[model samples]
Each structure stands twice: as structure tokens, then as C-alpha cells.
Target: MKKNIYLDFAYFIILASTFGAVLVLGAVVAPVVFHTDVITVNLLIDPYNAGIIMGEIFHRFSYWIYFVAIYVIAYEAMAYKMGQRDAIGFASAFVVVCTSLLFSAIYVPKILSMQALGVEATQSDTFENIHIASEIDFKILALALIVLFIRRLLILRVPSK
Candidate 1:
């Protein structure tokens, strides 16, 4: 019983951290940086520089995401070993981890490399496509994290036999 409670606590912490980070980055930080006139002067001066700046910010943020991914994977694996057979929760968390790894290891690095090529390259069709794909992936990851968090909460509410 104590082990289960500890596992639940760890899972909750991991889920909350993952969810909060994604929400802040997707819902708050990116919108504020891209949509608002908060950085109008910088954008007007050199849009490429602005993009590079944002890319750097996101790159730094990805480090935290990588940690979250590892934590989710480790926790889920531990739960499975302990005989917790919540398949939905495990699968959702696994999706989150995989998506995070894909984004951080593959997409983000590609985007950063493109950003390094300056505004012209970033304006090209390939860059645009990749950017769109990254956006879609990010949305998927965010949704997965939410699902995992909710699923874990539901599992916690159930009485143990």
C-alpha cells in the first residue's frame, strides 16, 4: 500500500510538471512571443533574429521536456513492474514520452538548424512545412499529457482491492 502511494505521488509530480511546462510553452509563452506586439520593435528590425531568439528559448525549454519524458517513461515502467495494469495510463504516458523524444531529438534540432540558416531559409517551403509539422506534434503532445494526467487521477480515485 505504501509503495502504491509513493508511486502515485511520483506519477502525479511527473504528470503535473509535464503538463504545466507544455501549457506554459504552447498556451502562454509562444503566443506572447509571436502574436503580441510585445516584441514589435525586434520583429520589425530583423525577423530572422527574432526567430533565432525564440528558437533558442524553446531549445532551452526542451531540456526540461526531455527530463519530463524520461521521468514519465521510468515511472510507467516501474508501475508496470509493480503490477499496476492500467493500460490506458501507461499507453498515454508512453505516447507523451515518445512524442517528447521525437520533438526534442528530431524536430527541434531540425528547426534550429534551419533557423541557423537565417530568414531566407526559414521562409522557404520546407521550413514552413516543418514548422507546421512541429506545431501539430506539439499540440498532440500537449493533449497526450493532459490525457495521461487525467487517467492517472482517475486511477488514484479507485479503491484498491
Candidate 2:
């Protein structure tokens, strides 16, 4: 296998693991720490806001931190194999992921704490913007991966010398 192929595979593996953990860890944590009903109740919550049904806001935020850590590792791996332009792209994605994680980890906790203390927390447009940007990066990276896969296969189509 070519070095770049293996690198890409490793990126996929690690990054996928991060995504999987986000979902799985949240599920596991819900019952173990919060409550069995908490998970179900969380479903009704705004996912960010109280929404009259949401569980502890931090419950969701903790998962984001875990997910971001995963992407940071994967981005670091992918950034190595490409040229300058690709490097910039990977860096941009990494920044987006890192920023999202930062907000999710740092701010989410603060919001949850405020809410827990019965202190009114103000909602801002930043949260929505960050979410949007992170999502866009995720889609772009996935699309790029598909394109790279096709390109690699085409490169391999040449008859053995």
C-alpha cells in the first residue's frame, strides 16, 4: 500500500473513532452518571438550551470535547501528506473543529453551570455560527476523502511497468 493511502486510512480510522465515541460515550454516560431517564429526557431538550426538557447542558458539552480531541488528532495526521494548498485546507478544518470543541467544552460547561445555579444565561449568535462552520468543514472533508479515493484508484489503473 502506498504511504498516502495508509495515512488516509489512519485518518479515517482515528477520525471515525472520534465520531463514534461522541455518540456512544454520550449514551453510556447518560445512564451511568446522569440517569436512564435523563438520556430519554435529553432527547426532548434543545440540545443546547433548556427547552423545558433538556437535561444538564454540560451533558452534551462533555461529548463535544471528546469528539474534538479525535478530529484534532486526525487533522494532524492528514495535514502531513499533502501539498501547501491541501495543508491549508486541513488546517482550516482543524481550526474549525478545534474552535467548536473549545466552545462546546469551555462555554457549554459554563452555560450549564449558570443554568444549574439558576442564573440566567444569555444566548448568542456565535454558537449557531460555530455549529454551522464546523458542519461545513465536516462535509467538505468527507467529500474530499471520496474524491481522493477515486483519484487514487485511477492512479493505480496503470498497467504494472
Candidate 2: misplaced stretches above 4 Å? 1-7, 13-61, 74-78, 81-85, 119-161
Candidate 2 lDDT tens digits, 1-161: 23455755654565455445444434554334434345565444343344212335345545755565565556455444432124444554455465455545665554445455442333445544543454454444444434443433443344333
The numbered model that scores best in lDDT is 1
lDDT of 1 by residue, 1-161 (tens): 34667767877887787778777877877766665456555445255666776788879978988988888888788767766669899788878988898889888899999988877889999999988888888888888988998987886687658
Off by over 4 Å in 1: 1-4, 36-46
Candidate 1, pairs of clashing residues: none
lDDT measured at residue 93 in model 1 versus the true structure, 0 to 100: 86
Global local distance difference test of model 2:
0.46
Clashes of 2: 0
Q: What is residue 7's positional error in candidate 1, in angstroms?
A: 4.2
In model 2, where is the ten-residue run with the lowest total lDDT? Answer: 45-54
TM of each candidate vs. truth? 0.87, 0.41
* Candidate closest to the true structure, highest TM-score: 1
